[model samples]
Target: MDKSYLDNLKFPASFFEDEVREGFLVTSMMKRYWASQLKVLSFVVQICDKYNLKWYAEYGTLLGTVRHGGYIPWDDDFDICMMRDDWNRFFEVAKKELPESFQVLTLSNNEEYEELIGRVVNCNVIDFGPEHMEKYYGCPYTVGIDLFPLDGIYPDEDKEKDRVARTRKVLKALTLAELADVNNHELYLLLKEIEKENKVVLPLNDKLKNKLRLLAERLYSECDVTECGNVALMPFYIPNNDHIFPRKLYEDIVELPFENVYLNVNARYDELLDLEYGDFLRVNKSGGVHEYPVYSGQESILAEHIGRNPYRYTLDANELLRSVQRYIMRMTRTVDKDTLPNAESMAGGSCADSGAVIKKKAVFLPCKAKWWKTMEPLWKKYMDDPGYEVHVLSIFYYDSDYNGNIGERHDERALFPEYVQVEDCEKFDFETIHPEVIVTQVPYDGFSTFMTVHEFFYSGNLQHFTDELIYIPYFEADAPIEKGDKAWTALSVMVEQEAVVNADKVIVSSDAMRSFYVDKMIELCGDETRMYWEQKVESFEKSAETEDDSGRINNEDDKSDMNAWNQFLGKYAGRKTIIYYITIAFLLRDTGKSIGKIRRALDTFSDSGDKVCAIIVPQEQILNDLANIDEALWKQFTDLVEKIKTTDNCIYDEKGFSLGYMDKWSGYYGDASPLVRKCVQAGIPVMIENIDI
Candidate 1:
């Protein structure tokens, strides 16, 4: 083996240099993810056909089918919605009727199979047949899937659709909130205790809790004022008394052909589908991993490459070997030895040149070179005489012309037989391409990321791909990007903030980002962390930090915590709160309203015996206005306040009638109003000082 090729090899930036390209790859991977999704959708069609069940591609999945003709390529999974009755019926059958390789997984079933919940439920779950079963073989975890149930709603010509839409949104929010809850166990316990103490009982128990949750969640999700009013005061609990889909929306169901399978689709699909996605019926042009490299500025090739690629490469192979062998020769080349560099030395040198040696010894794959060459010929001869298979992986991508100007090159290079396509690498059944050996063109640091897949390719069901496995990282693991450190830092911050208390404690601004965060958290916390409703608030509360729970003037210890906490709550008054606005208003309204109303609205906060309740009035005008209240009405209110008394609590804002100017701000109804701003500034929390009635 010679050192020329090893010396010549230099890291290439063409494959991994641009953030845009890398982002495109991420998007492309989603497309690949959907291929698996569509397969599941096709199966759903089969299930509906065989068992006579009715289903609709509801919500995003429905939007995808109607608009794009299949699963949304950008989407990582698929969903099907059924009426509540149909959902129950399907679950009954799916439990006993689904193929052994696949089954209906639900949030309710999280306890039985720990892996089926959290990010696992959020990941792609459609099996690509029995051959792909090994993907989950010994996984000890379940991946994500899609199935939504459409609950009953009261019939209304104008409001039903809006109600349905709102319900779906709420359901989604509940799902996200519950799944993100870190302290689910604690929350569940809290709810259990709360329920046990009261007979007036809000639904927060086990069997009935989920049902109650579905009901509350449904109401919260409702968008139509009419439908909400209809159900707002219904006597006793009603569980989806109305049909999941109104008769007008779904008059009849029809079957459609998809990938050789028949699927039941909503009858009015074309109009709705066309409206959302005009190209809703085309299959993908290609089926594999798409390479989208970032464009590197020539000045910072290494840094840009690191930024673009998930893995790193080893270019200085000769220098690497020399560094390792230098010590060897220095230590072994003694006076007693012939100094001839014996067969042992040659064997070691030959090992350096051979692919197997490189695969076993090299930390990362060597990059392709132009000028310099390695001792490949010598290594080839050494292996040929001794009987060893040699295969090397290389990446080919567009490069500049000789003039150094940016231009595309079209050189067709023979990739190593071991260089498996990324798509082929996805599934576990890798037996088709048999060889004595295999090599990867991946960088070193990225090795850990793909280690599981590679391990399966060699020792497990994929043994047919290679008789013997040779593992080399695509690039060196010690890339400059420091992703591992970033991850560690994130985890550290999470611990410090107690973000793990519930999933939502780690607030993400978008659903996509939320999904990513949830996946990472689940990966960190494993299956013991399931989703629950009670934990949702706790998690959200931590992230929001809008209230100072420690500010209660109860215990002496809490006093020290009160100053900063009160200031923090005051700060929250000026900022936008994404938390439930209506709930906040309803709770605060109790301060100026009847004692019974306050007690009913915020049972937990109302009973907290040692908390100061303040009604802030920033205007002298409002206070003067309050002084003009009817004496009899004021007396009645005073009596009510006395009955609703709690120690360590008060109704005065020491800041008094001093007011600050409020700039124009947005309101919950998506309107900008200076009057609303004035109300917020002068009469927020409550205008108790000015409430004459």
Candidate 2:
């Protein structure tokens, strides 16, 4: 590379004097440091590009671009700022994309490094610190660039000041807490003094950093950025000035050349520069008054000279590099031949050597084991046809007990054939596996990976991911709601409304469901978008032939092969069976009354002894909520069921034996349930409790 870029830059006389005193080459050191910074910036830019996150140059980096067309002669650090949302998104993507050479340091990740702003540090080289700064001295320190998050500020001046003041105090306390761990008594004492001076008590503890982080988040997110007049870098801790700038100045980005690479900067760079540094174009005399830390090319040499490396506690570079490489390869690698169409054709221009049209890629994300029944038919339809390639990513282990500690659900896995490929949520990579169409049953925030999809087909709730959105409304029973169930009901209604409003095409099982969702959309969004919602929603009746046996049959010959449901059914031979279903809502409301009614009804039927059996099935939610029920009510309900089970013709199957075993029953009697709709469609009579048959 040419060294000509550094030739024309003027250096202060003190710069050379300091280099002689510190025993390092001033010009060569700055050049090396600048190169290292550019490397980190390049890696950051690469990550942003891969993940579609936006970032811009800020502070010293921006100042250097306009005033010097590169690094300021005296400045050694690089700075970048992103809107709060982009900043968070970058961190999420960086978790997988950042190379080993770099480490993103924040208060949460490295408390000892204790700065509100995040830093992307180069791990390859160490910076030798000044002797007086005992904390950083003898530490292996890397040259790093600051990444400040610009958060929305309150529109009112007084509110903005109050927010800044509160955030600053928390930042001070957090810094002190970190210092306390390092045995920096003076700084800790200073924090106590500040607290005493302000007539408040702030504890120096481990939670200080998290408390500060939460406060900062609230300051940024409490107000809407677009509506607010100004945005500020809340954690910068600048005195007198709040560091707030006009929102317009930072909203749009423009490209500017820094060193050999072009980087994004605020569109109104002139105003931003002037606000931060008055007369920014003028070079400061007296060496700019900023401390310049000595840099070393070799880690061991710096370590030996300083007695220890300060950054040893930071992230491991080699491990991070390997992880980054794996992530990149996984993202760019060709899709497996079994799961996709021609790999070469998908990568290159055409679909096949025959010059046929390319097959589109579609992915299905089922949130639970039960959802597979709804999505599998569509998956098979596409899998059999050559016009499309299909893949399944399921959150099968979402049952509360299995969450966070996921184990193989062998039963759920058996639902798919060996030829079909299914990936669990934890292992699925959204960036690497690009799908043209995405079908999802649940729109919970847990499946954030689906946000990257181009064409989204939501079977239930709505998500704000794509314009090419398709909504498929599923059947959900409207059970009687108690006072505590109102929030759950409201959220369910909101999710459905959002799905209808954003849907480009809405598919429902019946005209009644279509009309119901349409009215909901109009209620939530008003009549202005009613025509659009009405035109998009259409009913698609489920095919009669598509219904499969509700329960998985085990015919392995061994006595142990029989499931509990089959074992329970085996007890009754040549008897007419009626299956009854119940939900958590039914149990939680009028607990004593509902149980009493059930007991009386079962006892009345048992007296006849007409060679009939009644099987009860409770949903999983009801079983799980058993622990939360009032102790008195739970005991009464359990005792009632026990008493009812004594009846010769009644069998209380509390383990939900009859849920998917409707095929084994002669008739159905239950509160309105999703299964009721299916049974009614299959020409089976359903006697709903509290409603006319």
Candidate 3:
């Protein structure tokens, strides 16, 4: 390889002499370690660039770049920093894009690894030390790069000083807590006193470390650095020794060569580096070279000790590390035999183990007949699962004035086998069931059985007893169907937002549907809620087999009527069939304007002699509104209906036949409806009244 890159650097003779003395094994190991870290660095840099995230080389990594033109020759770690915004964004993007072998470690994510900074760990290779063995035990120790969040400091001098002081205090308390082991009675008593005074409980473990890290980051990020003139290198290694710099040093970023790739670095590196390390160029012989006990190719050792493949738990870094620690402690007898917790105890010995009585209760509530039809297959799956006791409940109360008359309690007994118990929510003892998983079609707090189910579950009241609130948001209403008054539309939006926010998991019909909800959730709720929902929300395209078959209607009577209607339309087979379906709410409220528009369009089609037959199916709601219509408007509507009925090429299907079965027909012409999407999906042409011809 080319050694020309190292020619400019004036290394002391001792450095090469020490390398020679250590032999080829140590030198080769160091080279491999550096190479691995560089690979990680490249991976991270590529992701940041793809996501448009700003990051810069920092600390020892930056020092190495400036002093050695690459890794410090002895250095084994890489460090980088991003502003809090960029840092958060990087993690969000990196979680999905990072290679399978690479794992992202953070304070919140990995319990055993306690640090304010995050790490991108390479699981393919093992790199651990004596300290790692002691702390991480059975965990798979891997090569990783550190990622620090550069937080903004308060512009106000006094406020900044106060913030730093408070952070230092928290850090001190955390350190003391860690040091206060079971043997250190005096230290433990001192920590207790400190905790009582500060009103901060300090547990000497991962929890305390996490709390302190959060506290420090929060305190540091209190002020907006972009708005302010200063920034702080927060969660710094030393307490009370925060390195504050002018925000200008961070604003202008420049790319610098580090190994084979270029890295983003603060433009004002001279000033920043000088502030960080006084006389940075003058390398102290003692401090310049640092070494740590690194164990290479210890994957087998980790796997053998942990009693499981270390790589399997890479995604769950915290648990992986904890397992490692526990295994090491068990092997070395470092932990007291009487005090040490058992595997069962550490594993929570609850629902995790097999053969444990699976008390998982799942309740599926179908608010409407259509919803029941859509979710029936899912109900059967849950029924088949021995682990789950599934309760299928239906609420059969419908408003007679609005939803037509509901008769016979809508029995679902015939749909399922005798083993399945289909109960009515009105009569069912929901309190006794005590369901852990609530699966509902009506996810919102709206004027539906959703409210009734919510009441039954005591949802959003008292303690949240339900474990998983799964919402199957199958219906996609892109725009408000309501005319004039937007109150109903607003209410619908609110309900959807509530469902998006509160539901533990949202099952969407398609990826398009998922994206729509994701955008809507983000718009309704902030970024944090959006992030939560993104993780929880998933897409499962409805099976074609589950969809209502073509020509199938709700009941036998409706089916016969639709068949007869189809037979009637068959007489006009020579003509192009145009299925005109419109909501009456829009028709009546538009003062006959919508109908007039349709009339004109139809007249034009007739005049053109295009051999087109129009089938106008008005919504049931429109038929109901006819009773309230004034004489003049009523006459106008009837005249239009009469004209269409009398016209040789037109037929009125009054029952408003199921749109799903309209595939045998030619095209759709009406106001935009959710059914239009279905028509498009079925390869039927759509012509909206005003928008499309």
How many steric clashes between backbone atoms does each model show?
Answer: 38, 6, 5
True-vs-predicted CA distance for residue 434, candidate 3, Å: 92
Model 2 lDDT-worst window of ten? 16-25
| Model 3 agreement with the true structure over 1-693: per-residue lDDT tens digits | 222221132222112111211001123234444545665666788788788888888987887666545565434668889888888788877878887767888766666667677889767445344443222222235767889887776668797677666666666756765766534666566556646544677665546556766665566666775777767677662354658777777755555556555566664465677678875544432233223424334644765677743322112334323423433443355346566876567787754575667557888876655445546556666787888888777644322111122223344444433344677566755567657678766543322211123344332320143556677753433322223112222222333433444456677666755665666555445565455556666877556665644124335656576676567777775566788876543454346365678677667656646477887787554565454544566567777888888766777878765344565578888753444545665678876666222
Model 2, position 193, has a per-residue lDDT of: 57
TM-score of 2: 0.35
Evaluation by lDDT, superior candidate among 2 and 3: 3
What TM-score would you give candidate 3 relative to the actual structure?
0.36
lDDT of 2 by residue, 1-693 (tens): 112222133222122111211111223234545655665677787787777777878877787776555665446778888877777778776756877656777655665665567788766455443431122212334666788887777778797677666556655655666556724676566556555544555455665556555555555455666668777776543335557788777655556546555667664565676677766544442233333433434544665676643322112334334433433444355345356766576677644565777667776666444445555556666788887877676544322110122223322554543445777555655446555556665432222211212122332222233223344432232221232132222223323333344344656555755665566555545677567557666765545554553224233422343354456766665577887775444454455466666666677668847677887776554544444545675677677677767777777787665655555577787654445545654567777664211
> What's the best-to-worst order under lDDT?
3, 2, 1
* Candidate that would win on TM-score: 3
lDDT of 1 by residue, 535-650 (tens): 22211111222123212223453454444444634633433321101111122223355334433423433344543232322222222222243344345444544543441222
Residue range with the least summed lDDT across 10 consecutive positions in model 3:
16-25
* lDDT per model vs. reference: 0.33, 0.54, 0.57
Candidate 3 RMSD to the correct structure? 30.0
Task: Give Cα distance to truth, residue 369, candidate 1, Å.
Answer: 20
